[model samples]
Target: MAALGSAGPVLLLLAALSVLSVAVFVARLIALRGASAGAAARADWLDAVEGGAMPGAPVGGGAPADRLLARAAALLPRRPAPEALTAELEAMGATEVAALGRGVRTLEIIGLIAPLLGLLGTVLGMIQSFRALELAEGAANASILAGGIWQALLTTAAGLIVTIPALVGAAILQSRIDRATDEMERVIGRAALAAALPRS
Candidate 1:
């Protein structure tokens, strides 16, 4: 606690950013995990839709992918051309992809800024060390100068500690987003193909 105080305000800011990054990561993980877990169910739903069991109304309450597939299934029967229908599905899927990616850019920003904040702390620490030496005139107090430098470097280390994990978490979350997107495309393609087929 004392060390953090000595490291100055930038350290506090980085700490807060670290907390926010963690929260975003956890929320995204839960959402993506839920979507992935429901993959098999989504596939089953797509198969049913292709079998011509269109629901009487819009289906509600399922994974994001399932909901998107349901919406596309409802829209498929309107007999839109395959190209136009595919384009519409892609647009809606893009929206869902964007929703899954919320807060990801914030995490990326934190990762990029944390290291710069650490460098700033290093500069500030060096300034304090020089100021201490100047105060001592010809007889510089080595211990005090070293203490000041040590405290300053603390913020840089803290910044790295926060940055590495935040960036790693962001990467992991991005991969999940990509996976979800691919699944959505596949489901949409299946629905579109079904719509293009002639009824027996």
Candidate 2:
């Protein structure tokens, strides 16, 4: 922390961003975990729908696929138009996908800006070092220039340290959300198909 303080505000801000990035990733990870049922359960739900019955989800209704299926089942008996059912399920799926994607953009922005912040810190450090050298006049030594250069370089390294994990976390979380979205579409589309409620 003291070292971070010495590096200056940009580095300190980068550290705070790193902490925030990890927190967002962890929170999203926990929220996305088990957010979809296993494939077999999904298959069973589709089968039940096709079999002309409204079936309860194998587990909780919190999963995206489960919610979408519930919506379709609720509308099945009404015998709504094929286009209407498709539209409704698609709308619900969009909402679910958007909810899953929350916080992912923050991770991406942090990953992108961290390196730039590091470069800014490096530039600031270099300016201070040059100013010190100018003040020393003929008394300036190699150590003075070298020490400043290395200290200035520290921000660059710190920026990369923050960037890699944030980007990787964003990628992983985004992939999970995408898979859930696909699942929601598949389950709901099949349910709509089985009930003869959609054009496919």
Candidate 3:
């Protein structure tokens, strides 16, 4: 309680950032894990449906990629021309990938700002410390200045602690989205090629 009371408003802001960073990281990680795990399998299903002449079924996996595939499967009945099919699939794929990217930019923004905010807090703390030392009329010792400096430095540490995990989580989530994108392209390209072939 005393520690909280002693902390400047900047430290409180940093504390909020730390909590927000952790929350976003955890949620995005879970969502990306599910989406990445389902993407390959859904791709296979989509390829089999469009290329291998297998009867299509609803893709019930609930991932973004799975939903995209499900939408494509639903379109099979119309026998869309190959170019039209490719365009539709490409558009839908872009949308799904974008959907997966939700909250990712927030992580990136938080990561970028946290350290700078910490530095600002430290600067403010140092200003307060020096001002206090001046007001002490030469009565204050080195220990008082030293304690104030350390307290100010605490904000910088807090900022870095929030930033590191947010950045790492953002990177991992982005790579996962990239892999799913590759899978979608591979599957969609092959399907388009197979559909363009003359029937047996």
Q: Give candidates' CA RMSD values in order.
A: 2.7, 2.9, 2.7
Give the CA lDDT, 0 to 100, for residue 9 in model 3: 78
| TM-score of structure candidate 1 | 0.86
lDDT of 3 at 200: 44
Worst 10 residues of 3 by lDDT: 1-10
After TM-score superposition, the amount by which residue 194's alpha carbon in candidate 1 deviates from its true location, in angstroms, is: 1.5
TM-score against truth, every candidate: 0.86, 0.90, 0.85
Give the candidate number with the greatest TM-score: 2
The residue ranges of model 3 lying beyond 4 angstroms of the native Cα positions read: 1-7, 38-54
As a whole number from 0 to 100, the lDDT of residue 199 in candidate 2 is: 27
Per-residue accuracy of model 1 over 1-200 as CA lDDT, tens digit each: 55433467878888898999999999888877866446776667767767767655444445566766767767776867777778888888888888989878988999999999988888888887888789889898788689778878887898999899899999999988887787788877887787787765
Error of 1 at 29 (Å): 2.5
lDDT of 3 by residue, 1-200 (tens): 24422337777787888788789878877877766456557656756664657565655785665665666667655666778778988998998888888878988998999888888878877886787789887798887677668767887897898888889988988988887787677656755665565554
- When 1 and 3 are scored with TM-score, the better candidate is 1
